[model samples]
Target: MKLYTLKTEIDAVPVADDFIAIEAPRPDCPDGGIVARVIYLSLDPYVGSRLRGRHMGEAPPKPMEGAIPGAIVGQVVKSRAAGVSEGDFVHAMEGGWQEFAAIPAGHFRKLDPKSAPLRAHIGVLGMPGLTAWAGITQLAKVMAGDVVLIDAAAGAVGGTAGQIARIKGASKAVGIAGGPEKCRLVTETYGFDACIDYKAEGWQAALKEALPEGASVFFENVSAEMAMTALSVSQTYVRGVLCGLADAYQSSGPAPHALNAGAIIGKRAQLRGLVVYDFYSRWDEYAAEAAAWIRDGKLAFAEDHADGLDQAPALFAKLMRGANVGKPIITVSEEQA
Candidate 1:
C-alpha cells in the first residue's frame, strides 16, 4: 500500500516527491482486523506540528521516509472481525492517504451513513467537532447567558463552538472569521449573534464593538494577536479556551502580542490550552450526544470535501494557507462493484 509520511523538518518547503515506498507482507492474522479502503482523510492543523521532530514527534526525518500524515476515515472492504464487515463505513485512527489500511477491530467505529453525512464522520462529527465540544463544555463550561466569542468562527472549531453554545443555552454567541463573507456565515449559518472580520483593519475594534459588554467566555482557536486582542477586551472572570496557533502556523516566531501578564492575572480569567486527544477517552459519550443533536437538528455542521488522496497534497497546502471553509476531508474512494 502507498503511504505518505513527513520525511523532513523543512519549515519553508514540504518535499512531497521525496516520498519512499516499502512493502509489507500480508498479515498472518486477519481475523481480528479490517482492511479498510481509505475513504476520507482529515488534513488537520495539528498534523503540522508532527511534521517536525521537535514540535511533535510522529515521524522523524529520513528524507526518503514517510511523506504522509495519517488521520482518516474509511469503509471496510474486507473484515474478519465479527462485529464489522465488508461495506461497513467506519472511522479509524488510520488515515486515508494510503489506498488501504488494516486497522485493529477495536479502533473502528461503524458510521451510520444513512443518518448523517458520510463525510461528517471525519469533519464536524469527527475530531474537529470533538475539539469544539470538549473545548467549550469540558474546559470553559459555557453556560446559558454566557457571552461567548469563538475566534476563526467560520472555520472548523470556531463555527461549531458558536453554534453549540446556543444549543446549550448561551445568551449570545460571537464569532471571528476572515472577512464579511464569513462573518455573515457565523451569524446566519452558525447562529452567532455577531462575527468580526480579522482581515479587516481595526478588526479588534470590531470585536469590541460587537460585544460591547465584553465576552464572558472566549473559545480561542487562533492565538497570539487575536488572543491578546480578545484579552484586552475581555471581561473579568472570562474563560479563554486556547486551541491552535493558525495565524502564525506558517510563520516561525513568538506570539505577536507582548501584553502584560496582568491581563490574565488581574481579570482572574481562565486561559487553558486544549487538544482533541486529551478528551478521546470520552469519545463514545461525546459522539453519542453530538450525533443526537444532529439528529434533532440542534447542532449544525458543514464539510469541505476533496476527491482523491492524490488531491491531498495540494488540498493540504490550501488548508495551511487557510483557504478551506470548514473541516477539509479528502475523499479517497466511492462505492464500487
Candidate 2:
C-alpha cells in the first residue's frame, strides 16, 4: 500500500517538508473491520491544526511517521463485519491518505453509489453537508422570516448552509466570499439572496447593502474581520454558529479582531462553537435531507480537485490560503463500481 505521512514539523503554509510518501504493508480486515480502497480524500482547513499538533483528544500525527488522517470515500475490498460485503461503497472519517485503509465497521458508513456520485458522499453528502445542516437547522434554528449571513460562503459547508437556510424558509440568505467569481457563484448558482465580495474595496458597504435589515443567524466559517463584520450587523437574539477559523489556520502569529462585545451583549446574541464529529450520530438524518435537496436542485456544491495522493500536501496549502472555490478533494483512485 502507498501512504502519505507527515515529513517534518511545519509552520506557515505547509511545504514539501510537511509531507512524504512511502510504501507500507497492506492492511487487513480485522474483526468487525472493513478494508477499503480509497477513492476520494477531502482536504480541509482544520487538518492543518491537526498537522501542527493542536487538535485535542487524538494523538497528532508524528512528524515523518504515521499515516496522515482524513475523511475518505472508498470501496470495500474485504469485510469482517456483519451486514458489510466486498465491493461495497463506504465512507470513513478517521481514514488516512493511503491507497487502502482497514477501518472498524463502526467508523465507516456504507454509501449508495446509485443514489449519488461516490465522491458526493464525501462532499455535499458527507461531513460538510452534515456540518451545514447541524449549524443552520439546530444551533441557529433559522426561521422563515430570518435573515442569514454565512462567511466563506463559496466554500463547501458555507455554501450548503446558505442554501439550506433558504430551503428552511429564511427571508434572506447573504454570503461573504473573497472574490468576484466566488461571490457570483454564491448568489447566482448557490441561490443566496446576495453575496458580498470581501476582497473588493468597501466590502463592508456591500455587506450593509445586502443585509439592509441585519442578519438574525450567522453561519461563521472565517473568523477575524469577516466575523466582526457579521457581529456588527447582527440583529436582536442573533445566533452565530462558529465552525471554522480558516483565517487563523496558517497564521504564524496572533490573528486578532476587535469584536463588538456590546453588539452581542445588547442583542443578546448566541455564539456556539461547533465540532461536526460530535454530531456524527445524526449523519443519516442530515444525509437524507441533503440528498433530497440535491436531487430536487434546491442545493448545490462544488469541488476543487487535485489528481493524485502526491498532491495532498500542496492541496492543503492552497486550500488554507482560500485558493479553492469549494471543497478541496484529492482523487485517490477510480471508483471501483
Evaluated with TM-score, which candidate comes out highest?
A: 2
Cand. 1 TM to true fold: 0.88
lDDT of 1: 0.73
Give the per-residue lDDT of model 1 (tens digit) for 1-337.
5655444446642333434444433333256878877777888776554554434445543444443656677778788888886888878854435777777757677777776767777767788888899988999898888888888888878888887888777889988888787777778878888888888998777778888888889887776667777877778988988887775554445547344577789988888888777887787677778788888888777666778767777767777777777677787877442
The residue-by-residue lDDT of candidate 2 on 1-337, one tens digit each, is 7898877766555654578898889897879999999999988777776777655555667766678889999988999989988988889998888999989869999887777777887778889889999899888888799999999899889999999899998999999999988998898889998888888999898788888898999988887566667888878788889888777765656667446677778888898888898889999778877887888888888888989898888887788677778788999998854
Predicted structure with the largest lDDT when compared to the true one = 2
Q: Rate the local accuracy (lDDT) of all candidates.
A: 0.73, 0.84
What are the per-model C-alpha RMSD values against the true structure? 2.9, 1.6
Per-prediction TM-score: 0.88, 0.95
Candidate 1 local lDDT, residue 150: 86
Q: State candidate 2's TM-score.
A: 0.95
